[model samples]
Target: MNVLCSESMKIEEEVSDDSGTAAVHSLPTELLVLIFSWLSVEDLALNVSKVCQRWKDSLYFRTLWCDKELIYENSREDLFIFVLSVAPALKQLSLNPLFCGDPAAIVNAICKGPKDIRKVHYNLSLFPAAVASRILGHYKKYVCELHLEGYANKHSSIYRNLDAELGQMSQLRSLKLSGYFDTKWDKKVLERGCLNLHHLDVSLIQDESDSYKPFLDNVKSHLKTLKLPQFKSNVGVLELVSSCTELKEITLCLDDLRCISTLQSLESLHIRWSDGVLKSKMNRFVRDCPVFGNLKELTLFYIPGLLATAIAKQCNKLETLNLHGITSCANIIKSVPSLQKLCIVDRLSLRMRHIQKLPRYIPNLRHLNVLGSFLNKGIPPKIISQLKQELPELVISSEPFVRYTKRGNKGYFTKCTDSSTDCSSDEA
Candidate 1:
C-alpha cells in the first residue's frame, strides 16, 4: 500500500507542473494587445516583431496606428512602410519634411488614409501647400490645432492661405507660427481674424513694420497668452494688454527697459536681456511702473546692478523669482520680503557670492533651484544650515550633495562644517 501511494504522488506532481506550464504559455490576447500598444513604432518593429506570429497578428489592430509623431530619414523607409500599413486611425501628426525622401508624396499618402487627423505640426518651409490643401479638404471634419515652424519670407503667402483654411476649421483652438513673416500676408490673416483661436504664438521677422497693432486688436478679445521675441517697442505690448482683458501671461524678449512699464495685467513676465540692457530697463520698470504690483512670478536673465533691487522692492507680491546669468543681484535679494521661491541658473560666479545674502530679504522662500557652475562646489554647509533654520522646507541640489531637510531637523548642518564664514567675502 505504501509503494502504490508513492507512485500516485509522483503522477500528481508531474500533472501539476504541466498545468502550470500550460497556463504560462496561454496568456490572454487582450493583455498582449495592451503590451504592444505601449511600445514606440521603432521599438515595435525591432523588438516586438521578433516575439512571434501572435504579436504580428495582434499588431494588425488599427488603433495602434491612429496617432503618430515621426521623423523620417532615408534609411528608415521600411519603418515608414510598416507604419503606413499598421496605423489607419492616425489623428495628430508631426514630422520633419526635409528628412523624408519624397515628402510631398509621403504626406499625401499618409493624409489619404482614413484617419481622423485633428492636429498637425510640421516644418512649414518644406511643406508643399498643394498637398496640404488636399489633405485638409478631406480631413477638415475634425482638424483643429496646427503648428508651423521654420517659415521664411518667401512662404508668407503660403502661410496666409494656410491660415485662411485653418480659420475655416471651427474646432481650431491653438495656432503657433514661428519663423520669418511677410508684412502683407500677416496683415491679411490678422484682418480676417481667427474666430476660434485661444492661443497664438507668432515670431516676428526682422521687419519691424509688421503692423502687429491690428493683429493684437483682432485677437485681443479671445487671446489668452502671447509670447513675442525681440519686441523692441512698448506701444504694441501696451495696446495688447489694454485691449486683451482675458490675457493672463506675457513673455517679452525685449532689451529696451522702457517697455517694461507698459505691461499692466501681466500675471507672469519673463525678461531676457544683457547685463547693461537689464540694468537700464529693469530699474526704470521697478521704479516707474506700478503695473507689476499684481505679478505672481518674475524671471530675470543676465540682469545686473540696481535693476534687481528695483524689482524686489516694487514687485512685493511676487511669489516666485528666477535669476539667471546675473552678476550683481544681491541688492534685489535684500528687499523681496514675500518671495516664496528662488531659482538661480548657470551663474556660479554670481550665485556663490550672492546666494547667502538672500535669506534676510526672502525669509519665506520655500524652494531653490541652483544650477551650472555654482552647483559644482556643492552648497555650503553653513548656508544649508541657515536655510534649514529659516525656511521650514528646503531643497538644495549641488554636485556632491543634493539634500532635502526640514527646519529644526538634526544633522542638517553636518554636511558643511564652516558656518562662521562671513558673507562679506562675496563680492558685489
Candidate 2:
C-alpha cells in the first residue's frame, strides 16, 4: 500500500508545477494505459511519453507493455534495450540480421528478457559461445519455434556445441536452420528432445546435400511439413519419406513423383524449379494416387504444364494455387473450379487477352494476385480496371506491372466468372 501511495505521490509531485491540465488528463489511468497500448514503441517514446509525467509513468504499467510480437530493426541499441526491459510478456522476438545496433547488447537484453518467449528468430552464431549458451539455456523450456542461422559442417567439427544446445529444447515444434549445416547433426539428440517437432525447413542452408534424412528419420511420424532443397533420389530418403505417415505439406523438386505418391496424408505440395518430367507419367501418377484429392494448396514453379493440369483436375478442395514462371495455365485454371486464391508471377509472354479470362476460368476465386513482367509487355492498365469493374466483389492486386486504384464505394455486381458466356469481348 505504501509503495503504491509513494509512486502516486511521485507522479503528483512531478506534475504539480504544471498550471493547466489537458482534457486528456480527465480520463482514468486504466483507460489512458488501454489507449496507449495501441501505440508503437517509437510513438510511446517520442510522442506520448513526453506528454506529461502522468503519461510517462503509465508507460511503466505492466499491462501496457505486453506485446505478443516484437521485431527489432534499425532501432537504436539504447531504445531497443529500453523496450525489451519493459516488454516482459513478449511471446515472439525477431532480431533482423540487418539490425543497426551493438549485437552483444541486444543479445544480452534477450537473455534478460521474458523466459516464456515461444518463438525466437535470430543468428546465434554471431555471438560468442558463452552468450549463445546463456540464450539457449534460458529459452529451452519456453521456445516452441526457432529460426536459427549459424555455421556447421558435416566433415569438420564447427558449431558442434550448437547441436548439443538444440537438443536441450524439448518443447521445440518448428525449426528453420539456415547455414552450412550437414549430416553431422546429432539426430539422436533431436529425436529425443523434439518429439513434437512437426515442421522442419532446411531449404536455405548452403549445403545442398541431402542431410535432411537424419531429421526425417527422427520425426517422420510427427512431421506435418518439410521444406527441403532439391529432390535427390536415394534408397534411404525414399524409405524415410514413405514412413512419414503424418506428413501433410512438402516443398521440393518434382523429379521423383514416386516418392511423393506414397504420402497419402499430404495436403500441400510445392514443386520448385523442376522440369523434364514426361506428361504421360504425371497423368498416370495423378490417376493412380490420391495426391491431389486431399490437397488444399499447390505451388507449381517451372514444372511441366501437364503435371499442373493433371493435379488441378483432382484438387476439388484446393483453396490456393500459385503458378510461377509457367505460361500455359488456362487449362490448369479451368480444372480447379473450387480454387479461392490464385497467384501468378513472372509470366513474361502472358497476353492481356488470356488475363481477361480469369473470371471465366475460376469463378469461385475470391483473391487474385497477378504480378510480373506480363504487365510490362505493352499491356494497358484499363484491362485490370475493367476486371475490377466487372467483378467488384472479387479482390485483385497487380503489382510491379500496373498499380490498382484504391477501391471506392461501388455497387456490387454479378461476377463475369458466374456468367454462362466466356466474356471474351476485350472492350476495355
Candidate 3:
C-alpha cells in the first residue's frame, strides 16, 4: 500500500508545477489525447473538459461513441440522445435493464443510426420486443455477433419478434441466444437464422426440441461452432452434428463423445455435464473422440480426471486448454507441443503439481489466465513469480472480476458469479 502511494506521489510530482511552467498544457495535443483516453467519460465530461478549451477539444464525444460500451446506471435522461447521435462509430453496445431508461429512444436511434454496430448485449429480463425487433431489423444486414439475455421465455413477447427477424439476419455470424426457464426455440426461425452462422449459442432455453434437424441442415456445411442449450440431450442434436461437414467448434453440456467423434475437422471442443444429463462417462467420451487429431483448443467444465490426460495424449496439436473442476493432472500425459494459452479458473483442487506439469507437457504455453477465483486463495503470487523465472516467456496472471462504474471508470474488483464466468469462457 505504501509503495503504491509512493508511486502515485512520484507520478504527481513529475507532472507538478515545480518548474514554474505550464508544462501539462504545453504538451502536444496528440500526447494529451492519448493520456486522456484512459479517463472515463465522466472525467472527460465533468473534470477534464473544464480544464481549458484545448483540453475540451481533445475529448471527442464521437470517438467515445465508437466504443458502443454503455453504462446507464443512474445516468441522466439525455444519455439516449448522446448515444443515438454517435451510434455510427460503435461496434458493440451493452444495455443494463436496472437503469435502462429511454429504451425506446435509444433503440430508435441505433436503428436509424449506423450499419456498423455488430454486437448488442441486452440484459433486461423484460426488454420490450418491439425495440429489440426494430434495432435488429435495422442492423440485420451488417450485425454479425448478437448476445441477448432475458427475452426468450414462454411469457416474453420478444421471442416472436426475434423469431420473425431471424430470416433477415443475413450476415449474422455469432448468436448467443440466452433465455429464461420457460423459453422455447422456434424451430423454423432457428433453422433460418442459422443458415449462415459460424457460431451459435442457445444454452438458456427451457426445452430443446428435436427440431434441430432443419437448423443443422441449413448450416451443416457452414457452421463452425455450436453451443447446446441447457437441459437438452445430445440425442436431439447428434444426427444433426453428424451432418455438419465443416463443424469445427462445439460446446456441449452433456458428456457425449459419439456426437463429436465423427467431426475430424473440429478445432475447438468444450464438454461438460448439463443440469439434466446423468452420470458422465467422460472416459468413454474421451476414448471415442481419438479421431480429433485436428483439434487445437479444448475446454472441459466440471470435468472428471483422466479425460485431460486422454486429450493431452491424442490432441497433440492442441493450442489452448481450459480445465475447471479438474481434481488432478491425472496420468502422465504426452507433451502437446503447440499449446499456447491455459486457463484453470475457479477450481478447488488445482495445485502446484497440476501447474508444474504444464511446462513439461506444453512446451510453447505462453498466456496462462487463472482469473476469477472465489472458492480458494488463487494461485500464490510467489508460485507465479517462481514459474516466471523457470519459463520467462510464460505470462501468468490472476485477475479478479472488475466492472464499470456509473461514471464509466473501472469499478472495484470482486468475485464474479459462475454464470458470468461461463459466459466468458469462449472469449477468454
Candidate 4:
C-alpha cells in the first residue's frame, strides 16, 4: 500500500510539471500589447483586429497612433472613432474633406475633446469658405502647421477667410498653401501676422504682376527650407535666397539654373528640367554657384555639361549624387573626390563608352546604382571582371544581378553566399 501511494504521488507531480511548461510557452497579454504598439493604427485595425478579441482591445490604446494620419475609404470609421476617443492627445491631423461631409462637426469634436491640438491639414476643394473659416478660427490658438489645397476662383470664399484666420495664429511655425491669393491680401497677412513661420511651401496662383516680395522678405530670416515649383524672375529668386541666411536645402522644378548662383548657404539642391536651353543655363548656374562648395548631396534630372563640370569641382564633399538621364556624368565623377554613393539612370541609352570614362578618383566609393536595360549589355564581361579586381572592397549590385567580393590582402574575386537568387529582391 505504501509503494502504490508513492507511485501515484510521482504521477501527479509529472502532470503538474507538464501544465506549467504549457503556460510558460504562451505569450503574456502585456507582451502582446508592447509588440502591437510598434505597428501603425491602420495596420493594427486592418490586420490585428481579425486576429482575436484581445488584439482588438489592444488597438484602442492611444500610444500606438502615429503623428501623421492618412484616411482612406476603408479605414474612415476607424479614424472617426479613434479621433473621438483621443482627440485631446492629437497634435497633427489630415482629413480628406471630400470623404468627410461635416468639416465643422469634425473640428468641433476635436476642440471639445482636446484643446491641445497643434496642427491641421485638410483638402479644401469641396468645403465652403465660411465653414473653413469657422473651423480655422476655432483651432487658431493651438494650430501651428496648416496645409490647404483648392481652386482659387472668385466663388471660393475660403481664400479670404484663410488669409484672415491665418493672421491670428501667433504660434504658427509651418504653413503650406496651394492656390491663388490676392496680392494685397497675401502681403498684408504674411508681413503683419506670420512673423513666427520657420518653414513655408507655397504654390503661387497669381501672375508675375503680383509682387510677392513682401511675403518672401518677411519670412526669409527665419526660413530654413524652401520648396517651389516655379519662380517668375531672377529678382524673386535672389530675394528669397538672400533673406534666408539659414537655408539648408532648396528644391525647384523650374528650368532656370540662374537661381543657383544666389543661394549661398544652400547645402543640398534638387532640380528637374527638360528643355535643352534650360539645361545649358543649369550648366552655367552650377559652375557659377558658390553654394555647391558646401553641398553634401545633389539630385539632378537632365542637367547639362557646364553644371556637371561645376558640381564635380565645387562639391568635393558630396556624399551622395543622384543623376537621371545624365549624359555628362563622366565629367562630374572626375571632380567629386569625396563621393561615396552614385546613382545613375540612363533613359536615353546605355553605352559602356560613357561609363568607362568614369574617373578612378573615387576611393571611398561604396554604392553604385545603374538603371536602363542596356547597362548590362554595354559593360563587357572583361570590364566587369577588371572592376571586380580593382575595387575588391566595393559592393556591386544591379537588380537581378548582384556580385559581391571582399578585399583581401591580395585582391581577388570571391562569390558572396549571402546574396539572394530571386529577381524581385532588388525592387528597392
**Which parts of model 3 are misplaced by more than 4 Å?**
1-19, 23-32, 45-64, 86-88, 98-104, 123-128, 152-156, 181-195, 206-217, 274-285, 330-341, 345-350, 353-392, 398-428
Model 4, 380: alpha-carbon shift in Å? 11
Candidate 2 residue lDDT tens string, 1-428:
34434544323222434665546686667767788889877777668867899888787787776664677765456666776776666677776453245877777787787788889887654556566677777888988999987555222333546666777788988999887666466786766664478898877877656666776687788889988666444677767877789989988777655677778899998877655666787678878787778899999887766667777788888999999877677778888888888888755645677768877877777777765646533235466566757666566655433333544469444312222212223322
Q: How close is candidate 3 to the true structure, as a TM-score?
A: 0.71
Tell me the spans in candidate 2 whose CA falls farther than 4 Å from its real position: 1-27, 34-38, 42-53, 61-75, 96-108, 152-158, 230-235, 275-284, 376-393, 399-428
Q: What C-alpha lDDT does candidate 4 achieve relative to the native structure? A: 0.61
C-alpha lDDT values of all predictions: 0.61, 0.71, 0.62, 0.61
Of the two candidates 3 and 4, the one with more favorable lDDT, higher being better, is 3
Would you estimate the TM-scores of all the predictions? 0.73, 0.75, 0.71, 0.70
The most accurate candidate by TM-score is 2
TM-score of 2: 0.75
The worst-scoring run of ten residues by lDDT in candidate 3 lies at 419-428
- In candidate 3, position 181 carries an lDDT of 28
Q: Against the true structure, candidate 3 has what lDDT?
A: 0.62
Give every collision pair in model 1.
65-87, 66-89, 66-90, 257-281, 381-416
Output the worst ten-in-a-row residue range by lDDT, candidate 4.
419-428
lDDT of 3 at 106: 60
On TM-score, the stronger of 2 and 4 is: 2
Candidate 2: clashing pairs of residues: none
